[model samples]
Target: MKTKDALYNYCLRLADSNMIHGQRLAEWCSRGPFLEEDIALSNMSLDMIGQAEMLYEYASTQSEAEHSADDLAFRRSEREYFNCLLVEQENGDFAQTMMKVFLYSAFAKQLYESLLNSNNETLSGFAAKAIKEVKYHLRHSSEWLIRFGNGTDESKRRVQQAVTNLWRFTQDMFEMNDADAALVDNGISFTTEALSAKWQLNVNEIFTAANINIPETNNTITGGYNGIHTEHLGVMLCEMQYLQRAYPDAKW
Candidate 1:
């Protein structure tokens, strides 16, 4: 693949994942367990969306069609989105939500940190800005996970179940594809293997402290990089793109 095409897909993968994950987190608006948490989730959702917008903007510059960031985000079909399957999973419960947050933030933090060293200036700058946000995200979710683990029987049971259910999808986050390979060759990105190893170490420490064991699951679900997502993503896009699709170029 040409470097420009590779870069565009790389940006789309990151942007799409952030965009979808932000939308999922946005669902908690006004529904958090408490006022502070509600606001926190909203703020985090904004952070993710803002990052996605910036990435989408850069991606637009690389496209021959000269698509806008909104076009890239709101006009894409489900098969065109490259977000990881892990981010597209339903937010089952507060515990389930936090598990997803903790896991994704852990991986994101490492990914962004490594990107800080990317040969691409734009990506490195994005990484510098994003690392700060993901750090806070990791801290907030990690503390919450620990609380759930040690708080009560119900909390423990719920969080434990969430871990078991979500563990299978975690492997999907580390799946590298052709775009990733091209980016790595050009020093624009790093290997998922190293990222996964660091992610696992950090998660292990937190899980050990939280009294939550990593599930012993041999099954792994992937293919999101290749645009093969769970049914959840298509449903999500229908709702997310409803306004854009129903009224083309409509604006507030």
Candidate 2:
């Protein structure tokens, strides 16, 4: 029973992460710096929303309530969200957005790779499907990172600053809790500790290729795992849950 609960929590975390990030990406729908990028980010947003649906569907199976994937995603309270802090951070400039995408895609790619071998069949299946999508996400983000980092002086300067600003929040992505412990013990989930090292290597490679240096800041902002998030998440939740809250049970 404990194992099942742990798995359920793990699934919700994954679902929330994708759902929140997808919604944020969708904000770039018509605002992308260029047409090609506009379509690209929109496509990524759709992929994340699709992945969130799969994860939330799996999570709903573990609950007694008849909550659908949309309910779990659109109806949850702010404190109920378990996504990492990185996803909720404000999309600053184009460089900032690219930095967010690069860092997150790198982490997700490594995590999904490890999860593909999880002992739990559901988790393994989800990871297998997500890995393919995240690979393209990584490629897209990496290409943009390189372009901005090595582009004109103003572009390079902005991307470099973006990288520095976002680095502090990266540590939260590896935070583990009791659910993670249980999942690790049951061999149903990969260890964040193990993934951290690989994530560093992956990010460093991209930074090197882009001729951008990882920031030297020692400050790390944590807390999204335990339900403590930034002010930005509240605004995001307000926008995301507005219709659901305003029109309770008014589904199409």
Candidate 3:
């Protein structure tokens, strides 16, 4: 990447999104619908956190800043985070959470699939490995969405509501900032607009089988790229960052 800062920022965007989403999934550690599902969510949480760590490590190598991966992962203030609005959303219910994951995983699958050929070797390798986990996540979440859609009346009601409530944030996932434009121009990153189009197709295919209707509109909620997040991120960060903040140098 010619502009190191742009590449670094892009990596932070990817890592921050993964870390926050993983933390949200970890909230279901003991609260999944069943024991098997509980274990599944925990595993997914680990997978996302691991991905985040790898991305952070790569970013650290590229950055002149002294922030370690842990510092980058935990020390940044809320406004410094560049995650999409989708991942940081509050987990509403079983259906809502699954829908959220489905949307993100679908995007990740296509984004990484294209990134396998990135000019940046570190990013290309990361995409190759991360795509596998993303595929499983897409499959898992899509299956649950189908089940919820075809199940009892209440199940159908809840899942549809999840779709309606979360639809706006979906558009924000593709909203790119200057750093993203710079990386894309330099071939260090893929264009999220193209990725977003593919993601919508995948989402439509799954939603079709589930008999769920997608709301069509130009009204999209964004600003996460600009570091403006919903109230949910602040809450999650407070809880997740408490230990690190309380003892800045705490070590095991």
TM-scores, one per candidate: 0.99, 0.97, 0.97
Give the C-alpha lDDT of model 2: 0.88
Error of 2 at 122 (Å): 1.3
* Candidate 2 residue spans exceeding 4 A from truth: none
Candidate 1 lDDT, tens digit per residue, 92-206? 9999999999999999999999999999999999999999999999999999999999999999999999999899999999999898888899999989888999999999999
Q: Model 3 over residues 73-175: C-alpha lDDT tens digits?
A: 8888889999989999989999999999999999889889888979999999999999999899999999999999999999999999999889999888888
Answer with 2 or 3, whichever has the higher lDDT: 3
Q: Is candidate 1 or candidate 2 better by lDDT?
A: 1
Candidate 1 overall lDDT versus native: 0.94
Instruction: Kindly list the per-residue Cα lDDT of model 2 for residues 1-252, writing each as its tens digit.
Output: 488787788888888888888988999999999999999999999999899999999999987678887789888888989999998998899889888988988899999999888988888898898989989999988998998888999989999999888899999999998888888888888678879999999888888988999888899999887788988998999998999889987868
Candidate topping TM-score: 1
Q: Please tell me which model should have the higher lDDT, number 1 or number 3.
A: 1
- After TM-score superposition, the amount by which residue 147's alpha carbon in candidate 3 deviates from its true location, in angstroms, is 0.8
List the global CA lDDT of all models.
Answer: 0.94, 0.88, 0.90
When summed lDDT is taken over every stretch of 10 residues in candidate 1, the lowest stretch is 175-184
